[model samples]
Target: MDWNRTKSIFIVVFLILNIFLYSLYVNRYNEAQSVEVAGEKTIDARLKEDNITYGVLPNSVESATYISGKVHTFTAADFTDPNHQANITDPKEARVILLSPVKLRNVNDDASFTEFVQANIKEGGSYGLWKVNRDERIAIFFQKTNNRMLYYNKSGLLKIQWNADNEVTMYEQTMLDNIEEVEQQESALPPIQVIQALYAKGLLKPDSRIEHMQLGYSTLVYLTQTQVLLPTWEVRVKLSDGEIEEYFVDAVEGKIIEIQEEKQEVEEEDWGV
Candidate 1:
């Protein structure tokens, strides 16, 4: 047997096997890297995708019907901060968000807060404010549409807050977001009709004096999970004994709506004469 020749042949075979193994390893490693890169596309590459093209959704009549008025644009790019971030979510859904003393000027309690809000919003400005509930320090104003007036906390409408000094300290608003302008603005019942409906419900007394009558949006259902705001007429009634009562009537249907009412306790008298 030729030992040197056999040894040389064995060495060559081993070298060939090592080269084949290395090639296989390199191919598998390359395949793994390729799969990882393909998992998530880069921003530029994603923009080029057939479905994505851009960030905005395509225009459709159905989509437009859900949104109202012109596309409102208000962004506080300067308000962006890591320490004191804004409490705004879903820019598409949140139309108006204003922080006090930030981009806000000339705010006062003497209806100035309401005035400032009216100036900010182009459509459905509050012509006559409907006074709802207020203490010595705070005053709230509601905007009136063609049909009825709406309050701040009622239907996610504009909420303006002014301090006792008559300067608008702060205000929170969520209008123009997902707005759907309908052709029918004059759909609600008038204030007089709303008052008659309240009388029909036995809520108003013969001597009940109407202190204030204003239109606003009422919360049909305001819950942590969901919310609904409907057009309503708010009437402040004062009885003969000097007691105040608040009544809400549906603006569209002219029906009385009672959310929560307090129970009255009367003293019983014994007739044991």
Candidate 2:
């Protein structure tokens, strides 16, 4: 006899329960949004407290994929100069000594040096000027693929040595063969996220300045013949003491890449020609 009234009561109770659950969900969503906002503001505040300054952060999101290539083997036909001496014994490299040191129009100008490389070296157009060591009398260039430089890759590098007279006396070169993307494209972490990751890891010091941020590739794996590369964000920082430091962050995975200085040194010594 009271079944109808009991059913009405149950419906009302269930309706009230749904309303309460909806309220809880709405509150949780708002709280999550607030936390995200606070987290971003905290990053800026922390940097400021540490006296760390940075230029404009990159706003655009980018996508990239892993790349792989075999080290190119140089041949005698690659070097045709009769007077200059070329050492292609390594097969993967070419070390050339100019019979006459090529004088630059402007020793201090990068374009002048780049011009010489483009004209004389094989596949030279693919290399970009990286840096010059005055004391060592050498200029280094890193190879580029798809307009992004492969950072400190020995397989795709050009090392030019100059004399006291500022003449390009000799150069060594290596290149990647069949360079191509190897994986599905993935979205790269935004520049700000990468910077925050470095700061969180204590890689960025107090009272420092983030001088520059660039996109590039770094060695992920070195095999017998092929090298695997990962897209990375290169962050350059200026410490409070005025010294510059560089760090690479895995763009897709957000991991800090520890560059192996010892490995690079061994490579240089092993292929010293």
Q: Which candidate is the best by lDDT?
A: 2
Off by over 4 Å in 2: 1-37, 266-272
Question: Candidate 1 residues 1-273, lDDT tens each?
Answer: 999999999999999999999999999999999875664344224323322221222121111111122222335562443322334454422223334333334433345545555665334363344442345333344434444443433333443444555544444333333334443444556554555576556676655567776555655544443444566666777776888888887777777776553111001111111
Per-residue lDDT of model 2, residues 75-144, tens digit only: 8888887756888878987888899888876777889779988887778899998887677777888899
Cα error of candidate 1 at position 159, Å: 3.7
Which candidate wins on TM-score? 2
- Candidate 2's displacement at residue 40, Å, is 2.4
lDDT of 1: 0.47
- The residue pairs in collision within model 1 are 68-179, 107-167, 107-168, 108-166, 108-167, 108-168, 109-166, 109-167, 149-215, 149-216
lDDT of each structure?
Answer: 0.47, 0.86
